[model samples]
Target: MLQSDRAEAAEAAAVIETQCPFCSVQCKMTVTEGGKGIPGQRRAEYKVEGVPNAASEGRVCVKGMHAHQHAVHSQRLTHPFIRSNGELVPCSWDEAFAVARQHLQGISEQHGPDANAVYGGGSLTNETAYLLGKFARVALGTRYIDYNGRFCMSAAASAGSKTFGIDRGLTFRLADIPLARCIVLAGTNIAECQPTLLPYFNQAKENGAKIIVIDPRKTATAAMADMHLPIRPGTDTILADAMLKIIMDEGFIDETFIQARTNGYDELSVYLNSLDLSQAADICGLELEQIREAALAYGEADTGMVLTARGVEQQTDGHLAVRHFLNLVLATGKIGREGCGYGAITGQGNGQGGREHGQKADQLPGYRSIESEKDRAYVASVWGVEAATLPGKGVSAYEMMELIHQGVIKSLFVMGSNPIVSNPNAGLVEEGLNKLDFLMVADMFMSETARMADLVLPVTSYMENEGTLTNLEGRVLLREAGRQAPGEARHDWMILCSMADMLGKGHYFRFHEPEEIFNELRLASKGGIADYYGISYDRLRREKGVYWPCPSPEEAGVGLLFQQSFAHPDGKALFSIMEGDPWKGVSEEYPLILTNGRVLSHYLTGVQTRRSPSLLARELENFVEIHPITAQRYRIRDGEWVEAQSEHGCFTVRARIKDQIREDTLFVPMHWGGVQNVNHATRPDLDPFCKMPGFKTSAVRIRPLHQKVYRENDSYTER
Candidate 1:
C-alpha cells in the first residue's frame, strides 16, 4: 500500500503534511480527507492549511488554498483516449498502449530514432522527470528530449554553471535573506507570483536593509522598493555593466576576494573602462542619478543579495544578462557568507530539480553534459548499458518544434505540459502539431496542447502520487500522496512501465513504485554536480528537507555552499567579461516594446487554475496593461478591445491603462490560451548560448478595435 494509505488505515493522524503543487515556493501544508463520499473515490474532501515549514513559514497563497480542485475538476481526463476519425474517444489501456507502441516503433523504423522525441514538464517530481528521460533514451532510443523548463531556468542555469561550476538556484537558504544589508531584485515580480516569500524581504526591510528593484514597470514589488530602476526591455546587461562600473569607480571593489576566490577581474576592468553611462541612460530609459544612487547603496552595504527571474532571463542575451548580474555579486564579495548570495527565482514547482535530472536536452542524470565522454560512460554504467550505445546531445525545447516543422521529428510524447498555450509563437506550435505523424500526451486534464494529441493517456496529480521535489533553494522535499486517483487515472510510473513492456524494454523499466525509481535515480546521480545519493524518502521525512550535493548518508545536506573554494578543481570561480550587445526589436511600424507575465490570480497557461471557479471569478481573462500615454498615442481607452499586432501575429484583449509602466512599453498577462493567447504576439527568437526563447521581449503596435467581440458560451481549451 502507499504510505498515505497505510497511515490512514492505521488512523495515525487525521491531517497529512504535504507540499503545495504550484510554484517553486512549495509551501508546506496539511491536508485532511474528511466529509467526503468514499474519500478519494468520486470526490476528495481535502482541507489545506499552511504549516510553519522552512519555505513559507505558515503562509498559504490563494493558489495553494484552491489547489484541491485539481483532483475534482469537471473536465479531468478519467480514462485513456485515442483519436478515431478525427475525434477523441474513450479507449482501454491495452488499446492505448498498443497504439502508442505501434506508432513510436513505426516512426523510429521509418525515419530514425531522432524522429521520435519526448517533451516533459518542469512541474513533475524528480523521480518522474528522471524516468521520462530514461524512457526516451532507452525505450525509444531518441536523443531529442527536453522539458518546458528550458523556457524558464535555462539561462540562469547556464550562467551559474559557467561562473561557479554548478547551478543550484539559491546557494544559501531563503531564511538568510533577512540578514542581508542590501537586496537587489531584478526582473522578478515577487509580490504577485511568490507572495509567500515576501515575508523574508519584509523582514530584511524591517532590519534596515535597502531593497532596489529593476524592471520596465513600477510593479507592486517595485513600488515598495527604496529605489526603482525602470529600465527598457532587453537592457538588463546594460544596467548590470553600468552598476559594475559604478561599484569600481566608487572604490567598492573587493580586491582580496577577487584575488583569492575568482579570476578574470583585470579583463573586466579593461572592458569597464570603455563604458558610457550617458548612452546607457538613454537606452535603459532611466535617469543617470537613479542608476548611480542604486549602485552606491548596494556597493556600500556590508553584505548584499541579488535575485533574478524571468524578466531578465527571457531575452536574446539572457545568459549574458545573468552572467553580468553575477559580476556584481562576485566583484563585491557578496557571496558565501551570511546575508550574501545570488539565486534565480525558479517559476515552476520542480523547476530546479527538473533541470538537474536529465530533463534538459543536453544533460544526463545529474546536470552533466551529454557530450562529455566521461559523463556518458559513468551514467551508462549506472544504467547497465554500454557508453557507445547512448545517444549524444540534442536540440533544445523550442528547436524541437522547428524540427517537427522541418519534418526531422515526426512523433512526440509530452508529459504534463501545455505547449500550445505555454510556448512562445503560438502559430508555429500549432503548425508543428498539425504536421506531426503521431503525438501522445499524459495529463490529468485536456490542456490546450493535449486537445491536439493523437492519443491522450490519463495520468495522476501530485495529490495522488508520492515523490521528492527540489525547491529553488536546492532543498529536496518529499511530497506525500494525500488521496487516490479517481476513475482510471494512473501514476506516471505505471503508465511508462506498461508502455515500456509493450515496446519490449520491460527489463529496463521494472519499477512497481516511485521509491524504486528514486533508488535507481540516486545511484545514477552519485557523482554528478547535483549528487543526490545522500537523499532518500526516509531521510527527507526525518530532516524535513535537505539540500543537494549530499554525497553520503553520514553527511548532512549542505545548505551553505562555496565557503572556501568554488566547485571548479582549481578552487576559483570564473568571471565572464560582460558583453555590450544591441537589441533592435523595435521598428518604426511597431514603435513599442511588449512584455508578458503572470497575473496574481492565475497560474501558467491556465490549465489547472482556470478549472477553479474561484480563480476564474478573480481573473476571467488576460488584459493588455499599457501606459496611459501609450494608450493615448493610439487613441485607446481603458476596458476596451485592442489589437496588439506584431510581425509574428496579433490578439485582441481588454486594454488597461495605468501610470505604473513606461510610456513606450506594453504589458500583458500570459495565462489565457487559444484565441485569447498572448504568446502569439511574442517572437520565438532564442538566446544563442542558452537556447531560451524571448518570452518577455517583443515588438508590437496596439490599435483600439472599438468593440467587444464575444459569444455567450465561448470555450478555449476544450475547443
Candidate 2:
C-alpha cells in the first residue's frame, strides 16, 4: 500500500473534510469512516456529506456524494502492467519502468526529442501539472506538450488574454452571482453540468434578476430562465452580433466607460454597423424581436454578467465567438464591478489553474508565453537550467495525435486523460496510438486509452491523494487525503519523479512531498499573471481557499479582478473585430446538425463516474435526443435504436424523441465511449487559433435500426 501517516485507532473512524474531485465546482465534503478496516491493508468505507464552502455553500451534486466509492472500487488498477505477446499482464514496477525507459530512450536516440510527446489532463493538481511540463521540456527535451484543457477552455483563455490581457475563468466570486441585475448565460447548462451552482442562480432569481439562456435546446437551466432564445446550432456569433448591433442602435453603449477603460471601439462599432439584425435573425432562425429583447434586458440592467461554456467554446470560431460575446459586456459597461463581468465557466477540476501552469503547448508557469524570450529566461532561472536548452512551443492536443499517426511523434506519455474515448475522432486517435513505437499511461483505472499502452502504471485517486485544486471561480482549495491508496498504487507525482530518476534526470526532480513542489511552483509563478508567490499549503488549509494573484501574505487574495484597471499595457481592454459565418451549412446527404454535450449523471468519458452504481443506474446508456419533426421524418420512434452517420464515421444509439430541441438539430451526450461513442462521428475540424476540435457541431443523418444490435467491440461496460 502507498505510505501515509497512520491515524490513531480512535481517530481512524472520525470524519475528514475534503473537496470533491469531480467538476470545477470543487464542492466541500466530509467523509466519515464507516466499515472496519485494517491498519495498512485496505481503506475504510466512506459516507460523504456536503460541507460549507464559498462556492457550493453546503451543497453537493450526486456525483460528488458518491465520489469516494470510486477510490476503492473493485476496478481500480493496483499494479503495473506490461504488454506481453499481444496482452497486458501484471508486472513488477521496476520491470515496467525499465521497459518504458528502454523504449523511450531508444526512440529519442533514433528520432530526436521532437519525436516524443506528452499529453496531460486538466484534472491534475497545480504541482503535478507544473512538474509534468518541466519533465517534458527539460528531461525529455521535447517541445510537444499539451493537455485536455485544449479541448475544454483554450478558446476562452485565448480570447480573455487578447481582450483583457489575462484569463482567470471568472472575474468575481460565485457569491456575487445573486447581486447582478441580469445574467446572460450563453450556451451553458449549469443546472445539470454543475448542479451545486443552481442555488446561486436561484438566489439571483429571488433578487429579481432576469436570466436569459441562449441555446439550441431547452435545457434544464433554460427551463428556469426568464427567456430562452433557442437559436440554431453554431449561430452563437450571429446572435451575439445582432445583440451588439441592437445595443448600439438603442444607445446603450457606455461611452464614458469605453473611453476610460477600453480601446478599438471604432473598429467594434464599424463591425456592429455592418451587421443586419434582420438577416442575422433569419440565419439564426430566431425572431428579430427575441434578439432585441435579449439585448435590451442585458443592456438596460444596472449590473449584468455574461458567461459562456463548451457550447460556444468548442466551435471552429470559438475564439471569435468568445470575443463577440464579450462585446455585450464592454458595450454595457457591466464589467470590473460588484456582480458584473464576463467569464467562461470552466468544466474540469483545476481547469483554471491547470492552464495557468506550464501544461499548454505554448505557455510556461504563471501563464507566460513560451515563445517570449524573457518568459523562457525567467522559467529557466527557476529550473536552474540554460534558457536555450528548453524546447520552443509545440503542436496542440489533436495535432500531436495526428503527428503520432504519421509516425512523426514516435512515443507518447499520457497522464490523467482517456483520449480514445474523449477525443474528437476515436478511430483516428486509436490508429495513432497503435502507430506509436512506445506508449505509457498512468491512471487510477484501466481506461480504454490505458488498455492500448505498452506499459500502464497505477496511480492514486483524489480521495487517497493530497494536493490542491482550483475551482471555476479561480479559488484554490486543498484536497486533503482522507483514505489510503490501494495496493501498489502511487501518486502521479511520485510516479513521475521515479520515472525522471530512471531516465537519468534525478537531479532536477528532487520532490519528496507535494508541498515541496508547490513551493517551487510559487517561486516560478512569482511575477506572472497568476502570481502565487505568497500562497502556501498551510495558508490554504487555514483559509479553506484563496484566489490567484496572491502576491503577498499581508494582502488578502484577489476575489475580484479589474475593479479599476485591466491587465493590458495601457490598463485597457481590447475589442476584437469579428468576421465569419458562425454556421457550417448542412449538406444534402447529412441534412441535420448534430450537437453533443455532457449529462448530469456522468462526467467526461464516464471513466470514474460510471463505476458508481448510483450514477450508472441514473444514466445506463447513451441516447440521441431528436426533435419530434426529425423523428417523424426518419420514422424513428421514441426509445428506438437508430444509426447516426457523418462523413467521418457512424455510431448506433437509441433515439429519444422530444420537443425540447430544434427540428433541424439532434443532441447527444458525449459521456459514452466504446460502441456508443458519439465522438466516432465527430469531425476533427479544429479552431485555427486555439486548436480546439469542433465537438459541438457536425453534419449527420439518422436512420432507424431494423434489428436489435450491439457493437461487438463495446468494452466500456465490461469494466
TM-score per candidate: 0.95, 0.96
For model 2, the superposed segments whose C-alpha errors exceed 4 Å read: 1-14, 37-45, 707-719
lDDT of 2 by residue, 1-719 (tens): 22343344334575777778888999999988754544554556667889888889999898998887777689999999999999999999999989988988898899998998999999999989999999999889999999998999999999999999999899888988999989999989999999999998899999999999999999999999999999888888888889988988999889999999999899889877878778999998999999899999998899989999999999888888998898888878889899899879999998999999898999999888899999999999999999999999999999998899899999999999998888888789989999998899999998889999999999999877888888999888888886688989999999989988999998899999899999999999989999988799999989999998899877688988899999999999998786856766589999899989999989899899988888899999999999998898988999878989899898888999999999999999988888899999999989888888888889999988763354678532211
lDDT value, residue 84 of candidate 1: 98
Q: Give the alpha-carbon lDDT of every model.
A: 0.89, 0.89
In candidate 1, what are the lDDT values of residues 289-373, reduced to their tens digit? 8999999999999988999999999888999999999999999999999899898999999999999889789999888879999
Candidate 2 global TM-score: 0.96
TM-score of 1: 0.95
Clash-forming residue pairs, model 1: none
lDDT score, candidate 1, position 383: 84
Count of backbone clashes, every candidate in sequence: 0, 0
lDDT (Cα, 0-100) at 696 in candidate 1: 76
